[model samples]
Target: MAAEPNETAQVNEIQKEYTRIDKDWLSLHYKISIGMVLFALAVECIMGLILVNTDMLNTTVPKFVFKFILVPSGVNGLCAVIDHMVVKSEKISQTAKIYTVSIINTVICFSLFTAHSAFTVTYYVFVTAIILTTVYASYLVTLSTSVSGLALLVISELFITWDVDKPTIFQSTLRLGNFLIALFIMFSVSMICMVVIHYEKRKNRASIRIEEERITLTKRLKMDELTGIYNRKALHDAMRDLEDCNPQDNYIFGITDIDKFKNINDSWGHQTGDKCLIAFAQLLKSNCIKANVYRYGGDEFCIIFHHTDINEAYETAVLIQDQLKKVEFKEYPELQMTASFGLAQYGSGMNAARLFMSADQALYQAKITRDAIRIHEKEI
Candidate 1:
């Protein structure tokens, strides 16, 4: 059987609500991720400049090493800008590509810094150890952190093997101790960042789920149990909406009631009468495509048509009456049912309640006159 008009409308509303929520979530996530990447890049640039100019490091490091560090750091900053632009506007694939480029740039920085021979054997070892720590730290910032970690581990091992015995102020044990401390700090920072990201994602997911549940519950509350159509509450809600409608837009109000409903219940039992009502509601829903159908109460339904003229509304009412002639009520083979329709078109200064009353009075007139449908026209 066809669904009632109100049920279909509710389903459409739910779909629109979910689509809106998902789009908003995706837009927000992109903006946040982009902002974070940009901020990280800005900080890195400032730190690089400070380190290059500071008295403590400027005199100690060679010009070549200084240039090497600055150049790659600049390149990494540029790549971060590109990442921010792409990630803020595109899907996950774009974000993944940006991250991939970022890792490659980081690799270039590691290679440049490690190849320089300015450091004493102990200092070189310490630098290699820092690179390895950074590689592991990268994993916390990125989904592909493990790949970076493995690459750094291999590079560090190779560098250490190549430079086994050069003289330095510090012994190997002290260098090792410093390396361990640096690694511990890097790992701790990365862990903190990862925890924050995970928590935010969890919170967003929970909010989306709660919103979906609320929409579902609201729909159920407004729906009629038998015909799966909008109940009396839904009619009131729609009527309330009419108050703010633009005056230029046409509106049609209709009320429909099943003919001889009580007699059907008395002669064929209430169950069969229910089946008839359900079937008839489906008929109204299927026929009235441009209308909002509501179950006003037992054996009575209402429809409101937005942007409809009097002639079109009357045509629709006639179509619905004709459509009911074909419904095959299987339980009572001899039973035939019809609906009476009353319609009113909106005019200046007509409120929703008054419009509904006008339609209801016309519906009463149709029932009294035994006509299939009646339309209320404003007096000339």
Candidate 2:
């Protein structure tokens, strides 16, 4: 019983954190990645329209645009478009999407690396490595897993082709060693970032747990111990809030008392008396489903019908009375039990206290004729 609600609350809290992390990551990734695409397009425009025309880099303008600008931009643009769709789809977890994006980025870096000598890609690999570690995950588990996979792919490309570019074994060895050093640097940087991210996630979970405990404490303060319904303090607070509404706003106010409550406690015991109260409280809540019922104290309870009229409130009270007659106590089958109700409505200019006094007076009248319902004489 206790376990179920606690587990559900924990799951709910986790889902909220999951949603926030997903939304934040998607927003950040889309902005930064799209910006990267724009930068690539800018390079395409400048190098093709101006720089290539000046015969710089000894490459044809069209060829340079196709190789350096258009190809990379097209791939990056496609990635941005696909990433947006995937992250927003709801079916895919952001963790999986992060991995997908990391792999794509690694491929992009690999493209730049393979297309040029190792010396030319220092700025590109350094920036990519730093950006790769920024997406947060659990205890560094997810971060490290995804980053290591991408790192391996990039490192694997270093030895992929031993073509004319590396004519000698020593030159190829040096290139591999250089790229290996960069990979090591990237891995070290990622390890530090993951530690920071792990700490932040722990802090977030701790904050949520604190908030949950605070709410539970607040609820306990307002809840009845035996009956599990709103207590006297809660009832008072509710009445205050109700009275804060406009004077003209109508509401039903009522009180209920167990028919011969003291006799049950005296005859059976306080424990049985408590069981009766709990059972009676459950019945009241079910019958008055539209209203809030409070276990005002022993043998006394209150109900509030927000925005309901006198007639409906009275009808509901009658139902509760009828239902009580059919309710059975397993311990004392021969003993039949019933409850009396007194109902009133908030008339114009009536404050919370006055309205409840009217109900209490009617309740007094009902008590005179046990197991009966009475409307306030003023309303009659």
Candidate 3:
């Protein structure tokens, strides 16, 4: 039952599409959240600055501070908003983390400016806020973001202390007294938080990878190796699951058997036989809408339908078999393929296994006639 080249290629294309859609969904969520956070931070900064610099403070705003801090922070915030919009449009996830860090850095700028103003005591609040931001970043790219945050902190210190007296030297000289100790404490906390965040991110990533592998393995297990249809094992599970459910009136069961399959293999070799099977499976997959198709065994296939009547199932089978006219083998130009179908519907008491057995018996009757459709009740 090894798949034909065309069928295999089609399956690969479908898998790739599934992966792309999944990636885009995750990217959309992250991008929207990033955009919201950036917008909120920008509003807070713009409004807070305007209020603080206004007569509400009853003091003249420092022009140098406004020029140095407000302009840079606003531009940074705007860049985050633009980056977020780009992510939304392009569905790109690679730059999401970088944009997040830039947004957080704007908040850091606001803190630096506040600390340099009359509220030098707000440095404690800034220290706490920055530590939290760095921890969030550690979850994204632990070591890299942590290093960038450290560099940004250094830059902020330079900006605040520029053109000021030398008394505020908290690093190396420790002239800021206990504030230098507080700085050391903050750095220590940041390092420890980053390590914790790093480990958590590593573990989460490993878990996600394991889960993805498990899903792939589960799919492979259920699929037939040759034809890419559900294998007998999956059929067994599907039947058992149906047995556990409440009986429904609209379920239809069907079986398809390749006509003169042994003669086909003997005449054209096993490779061509495989091509025929792949072609049939591909056809069933395409046309068996609202039904679960399985490779029962050998040259036998099955379709179980939900909410379908016996006549609808029969019409579908006829339509699918008629497509056999178009099936062309490269080596055998004169060969035509056909399948006999057995159709049945479930009653209130019938389990899926019983339902399919009835269909199997009908399929056997169809096989006797060669290329025919037989209702299980008609055979009985």
Winning candidate number (lDDT): 2
Measured against the true structure, the TM-scores of the candidates, in listed sequence, are: 0.68, 0.76, 0.60
Model 3 lDDT tens row, 165-224: 334454536445445564576577667767777785676567566656766777789899
* Candidate 1: clashing pairs of residues: 139-145
Residue 45 error, candidate 3, Å: 29
* CA lDDT of each prediction against the hidden true structure: 0.62, 0.70, 0.66
lDDT of 2 by residue, 1-380 (tens): 00013424764877687778766775675566666567656755774677655754565556666766666676667777886787677888766766665555555555444433424353245446345445554544345444654564465464554223433325667656665676666667666767777787787778778777887887789889888888999888888887777655557889999988999899999998888888889988888766888988788999988767788888888888788778787879976678988898777678888989999999999899788888898533
Model 3: how far residue 243 lies from native, Å: 1.6
Residues 1-380, model 1: lDDT tens digits: 12234424644665566556644543444344344345534654565567668764534445534444555455545655664565455555533543544454344434433433224232222222223223222333343443453355346534543223322214566555544564455455445545655675666567666666777788899889999878999888888877777756888889989888899899999998888889878887887777778999999999988787888888888887877767776666788778898888777788988989899888988898553788775411
- Score residue 208 of candidate 1 by CA lDDT: 65
User: RMSDs, each prediction?
Assistant: 7.5, 5.2, 9.5
Worst 10 residues of 2 by lDDT: 1-10
Cα RMSD (Å) between model 3 and the true structure? 9.5
- For model 1 the local lDDT of residue 25 reads 42
Q: Which ranges in model 3 have alpha carbons more than 4 Å from their true place? A: 1-127, 130-177, 184-188, 378-380
- Model 2, residue 264: C-alpha shift (Å): 3.3
lDDT leaderboard ranking: 2, 3, 1
